[model samples]
Target: MSSPLKRSLSTTGRSISPPPLQRKIPRLTEHVSSTREPSVDQLRIFSWNVNGVGPLLQKQLSFSADSLSPLRTFLKRHHWPQFLCLQEVKISSKDTATQRRLQAAANQSAAGDEPSYTIEFSLPRDKYNATGFGGKVHGVATLIRDDFGSRLRATRRPDWDLEGRVLVHELDMGLVVINGYWVNGTSNPYRDPETGQVVGTRHDHKLRFHQWMLDEALRLERSGLHVILIGDMNIARARIDGHPNLRTSPVQHVKNRADFNAKFFTYENGLSAVDVFRHKHGNRQKYTYHPRGRNWGESCDRVDLIVVSRSLVDPLDAVAETDILDNALDRGHSDHVPLWVALDMSIFSAKAAQSGSD
Candidate 1:
């Protein structure tokens, strides 16, 4: 009935400036002198599995305030995002020898017009507590393009180190960015230790993660803040999202069998779910995760993602799609392929309201 209010809509996505590009070795540039506004719309973002950023640092990457190589190049050339999120950083000390090695990688890759990105990382400060369902420790970082950093800003959440799997960076773009990495495989692993039977280890893990995932989701829901939950959730969306599973793998989380504890998480059509990637060009495949073997790989599941709130999707009228970026250089980019992204959040909010009433 009333005209919708026009507030600043922060375009949410990472700058190569986000931690991923930075931990690789964010080049520190001389502060450019300028009085200008940062671009908010038409944002760019990237998510990838860097294996472990630790080993590379040990090589040529230096940890000092000085700039490094390939890493700097990678960020410079690729520093397009208002923000960036990187997985598997192998977080170590600020003075660790590995920093130099990582710098070397950056030194070699720096290029292009992206010298504006200021890189930062989310390295763990305490011992990883694997005592939970998932193992402890890993790196998550954020990068800010010079404009975004000067115009907008970014910071990691204080609570993330406990899990060390997710990175929450609030960007100047106005949206709170949650860059995440759900545990690969289950923690309640192995068949019943005493039964000597091969139990459905993955099934047990699904339940655990589902609870964790939903708990996290509800927190977002309660905040009523604009949010984006992107990263590797580990659960295959094909088996859970909008489709029905004709076959159920004879597996279940040993601790909590019924995963959709309706009390904790949200589900679509009897399955836990989240939307991944947006499709404008339309050649999305069914698989996102892959097996080590090529032929007969795990083509049946969809895992890696760029998920947002159900509320955001409804209003934004956002469409979903997935691209499988599997290449030789990607051999060790984690067990899953990188997912391409496209989103139109501006149109989602209105659509979301209309859909909810019906």
Candidate 2:
């Protein structure tokens, strides 16, 4: 079955026509910024599922030329310092126009100021094309501030990177930030002929992806690098992570819930990861995604997450706070809200030194 979301461009090799610019929403006019500047010792990282960058760019055009683009506006307001991981960008790397638009937006700054960010992208190609959404399938992207971008030594896992699901950047600080867009489980399923069980669904693929991430996390940890994994994981860990009213098959939901729990709670070699937001907020009923239809009765889930290794949690918790950016006014941008954490890098001063020496 095809996805419910529409593609921005057609598969017939036609150029995309820009959507009509609508009047700027009142919320867009508000000027907001973080309470503090991101010093060399601190880094503010953010992640969001854009749904589709092509459509988002079109929306940005509707605003006044002097105003900041939607993405930049969000970054500035939240005071995102150095790193941004965007999932479901929905544009191929071959699409130079869209890629350039992202670059321009990342570099965009106040008048007479220089651009701040340099970007890297992972695009899906060939058999790895997870999204069958015509020629306009989605991908993931990582944008680093120019200052930090210069320190990026290399990208690990070339084979995985080609799937456009993961981008692991190896920083000179011996830190690795992985931006991932895990596969959304298949919607349709078939029953087994002999056992009479539902099988061959997308959830199977999602399970494999989760296992791969677990392995990757361990490998990175063993290499002695501080790791930050963030993106739209597309899995709700428990009943609290998702609205209870959403319709789902009992077996599928149960399996998915267990898979999510294992991914975060299970330990390998005595090491496990923690969900930053959940750790900070506890049992907060906040959600990062509000599915189609504005009806409150519909199901919503906190699938977008920021997970960090246990080693970094202590330092992060010392000086940082995490929250779900669920502004109702910004709901028009995408179904998924942005999730972020602000950390004073100074807390990591000791750990940074230790990692550097390794």
Most accurate candidate by lDDT? 2
Q: Please, what are the lDDT tens digits per residue for candidate 1 over residues 21-92?
A: 233332234452211222344455556655455433433335344344433433443434455566656555
Error of 1 at 309 (Å): 1.7
Angstrom error at residue 288, model 1:
3.5
Q: In model 1, where do residues sit more than 4 Å from their true spots?
A: 1-40, 54-79, 93-95, 99-112, 124-137, 151-154, 158-161, 185-213, 239-250, 253-274, 278-283, 293-301, 318-324, 329-334, 343-358
Native-vs-model 2 lDDT? 0.65
Task: Point out where model 2 deviates above 4 Å.
Answer: 1-40, 58-65, 113-115, 187-199, 244-250, 267-271, 296-298, 314-319, 352-358
The RMSD (Cα, Å) of candidate 1 is: 13.2
Task: Please state every model's RMSD to the true fold in angstroms.
Answer: 13.2, 6.7
Q: Residue 238: error of model 1 in Å?
A: 2.2
Tens-place lDDT per residue, model 2, 203-242, is: 6656767778877877888998777888888667766876
Q: Which ten residues in a row have the lowest lDDT in candidate 2?
A: 6-15
